[model samples]
Target: MYFTFRQVQYFVLTAELGTISGAATAARISQSAITESIRQLEEQVGSALFSRHARGIALTYEGHRFLRHAKLIISTVKDAEDAFTAKNDNVAGNLRLGVTNLVAGYFLSDILARFRRVFPEVSVEVVEDHRRYIEHLLISGELQLALMVISNIEEQFALSVDPLMRSRFRVWVSPKNDLADKSRVKSSDLRDQKLILLANEDLLESISGWLQGEELIDQVFLRTTSVEAVRSLVGTNTGVAIMPDLAFRPYTLEGDRLEARPVEGLSVTLDVGLVWRQGSPDTDQAEIFKTVARDYHSKR
Candidate 1:
């Protein structure tokens, strides 16, 4: 009889994840229940929101138009909740942002640009650091919020982590590499090849933990803190690097082409998102910025 907040949330999650099952898993609901919610939502709205495909679902023209309203509703309601529990700082205040090196290079610009366009009056200061250091800043109240890898956070219970995207690491190689032409690459395949490792400790640890199964952590040829350096090495066929989709590119600065293929047996995922102290009150500015980040990630 009415469009409830639960229906709106279900609709938005389905649109974001592009499947009922995905929405279910992400929201900790059942697939049938999600389906029924979408069905009731469509009935109440008097339009088909999604076009079903063999693989997944896609928003219809009307669905795309409605998505804006859904996000606005969700964000507005969440902001209202934040107002009661958190400091009601005006949207015009300065936002202290902590970003990790990997996120700063790969994902921060787009989020910052869109956020600036929407909240131009909000001043933003970003501190780029390692994941642990960023978390430290978040914990110490130096940062209002942070965008970083949340997959393996040491103190997860102390922070509120909202994941924006899942980035799984894979092998990156120059087109000239011997395995470049193969349909798939495996851990054993990379054991003998030269490896260029990113110097980010968390990433280094994730990559090492997986490759340790093959006893191949010692295969590293060069280690650098710069993602571009890893790219250059892989592009020039100097060494193969393993990195997540967030920072992986098919080309280097010199315009040399590269390739990325999934590792046959690796299951590590880098989930990046916003984090703040669990007990700390979020500023209004932080709430709005989080909305901007979510919208950007949803579109991608």
Candidate 2:
């Protein structure tokens, strides 16, 4: 037969207090009941847990070994109870969040910091992945929420997407490059400039569509993925790149070496949003996060 939780509790208490009377006192039970429970536990385990000493009980070697596992079980149970209580009544529990590097680099820090300030007990785990993988994980229930590139979202999936901000890509180049002097660059002006593009192929396709609509497709150049690579390449005058305005910030890299300007006759913008699975129960923590994001965007 297996030992009951109460029996394990009694045994652990007896081991800790080193006396049946002390264990009973701490557990608010009678000494006889504590002793009987410990006895039953010993019988179930088929081993002696305590040995009588001069004034109290001492653990046998087996008891010390069993004590560790018992403590783990107790701790796990307590943690579950605490998590349940916090989820139901407090905006404090474990949150599994996913964020793309782009999103985390730009927006997540402020939102998380504000959240920590308000709900100090809430534990947050952030998984940073590319936008595509992060979105897949979020839909699979592996993540509670995610900050992703809505420009890359597929319309076939049923997801609750909330637009947080709208931003456009600006072509970045060395400030000293010839293009820096132009008020606006035409689509055909990029014919000779090497180009770098970030992930989110759909956005790139949208840009292509815009270019095609304006009858300017054959003028395209090289496309690279790494934003850092783009920055380095542009800093060294290797090529120009298109990056989100919020992501590019101040249009300088390591110094006032790089500049970003709008290309003329092109009106391409992407909406970034918060995505979560539909029909999930709204927790206070989720609400807190939502409010923080909305308020943060409203101020910007």
Candidate 3:
């Protein structure tokens, strides 16, 4: 047999008050609601909990026995809720987090700085890698949190994701590139053009899957693991690349300017945010870091 918390609450209150009307008064609910809950609870247990009287009610032997267990259950639930809700003075703990290479370069510095200022006692350990690897570490419980591009996060983690920012996906082209004169470019416009991709093999594979229908994908000139290489290629008119607007720098290391054109006819965006395992609640130290990240985005 199964019962609900509300049913248990009504059973306990009715037992204490000895009357449905009195229970309703105590619970701030309709008298009929209290009666229904008690009836359902008794149905589950397959026994009448109380014997009716002219004035009120009296607990049967079964009622007395169940009352003890009911109180224990209620108390345990209260303790569990308190554990999650209660404020703790000690926020000192090691915060283990993961970030992708892109997030580490463009997003993590501000959040980490704010977190350190607020929770100096908390030690932070971070790992930076490709998004897929970061998610792997997170799901394996090797990381407490992951600050990465939260859009379309792999379902296997069953994570609790809170979006912090949405950065527009843009294409970086050289001034000499034909698209440089236009304010925007389309996926189809990439045809016959050499492209530079910055990612690990898995990411490249994913991008390739999406672009498989496009024949120009064969012309992907450089498959570099370095972001700098992508920037240098785009700046020197060597090739064009697509990335988030957060990564756009007008000038490269060699002082050559790069052109960023928004991608049209597509809903592509980088949804950056904090992600933690669902049901596995964050510790106080990690909670502080999450708050800092949230506040940093809100301010921006």
**Top of the candidates by TM-score:** 1
Which stretch of 10 consecutive residues in model 1 shows the poorest summed lDDT? 82-91
Worst 10 residues of 2 by lDDT: 248-257
| Candidate 1 TM-score versus the reference | 0.69
For each candidate in turn, the TM-score is 0.69, 0.62, 0.64
Clash pairs, candidate 3, are none
Q: Please, what are the lDDT tens digits per residue for candidate 1 over residues 99-119?
A: 877788788986786666556
lDDT tens digits, residues 1-300, model 2? 787888888888888778989999999999999988988888988888788878888877667768857865665565455445544345578778887666777778766765665567778898988767777787788888777667767633657888898888678878668788887787677767766655445456546677567554554455655666667778777777766776663323454356788987667776677888777677666666777678667844
Between candidates 1 and 3, which one is better according to lDDT?
A: 1
Which is superior by lDDT, 1 or 2? 1
Which is the leading candidate under lDDT?
1
Whole-model Cα lDDT of every candidate shown, in order: 0.84, 0.72, 0.77
Candidate 3 per-residue lDDT over residues 1-300, each given as its tens digit: 999988988898888778899999999999998888888889999999989989888777678778868876775565455445645446787989899767888889767865665556689998887777787777778899989877657754477888899887578988888999888787788876788887644344335555565555676878888878888989889889877777776667776777788766545566788987787865877787787687667744
Off by over 4 Å in 1: 1-90
Q: State the local distance difference test value for candidate 1.
A: 0.84
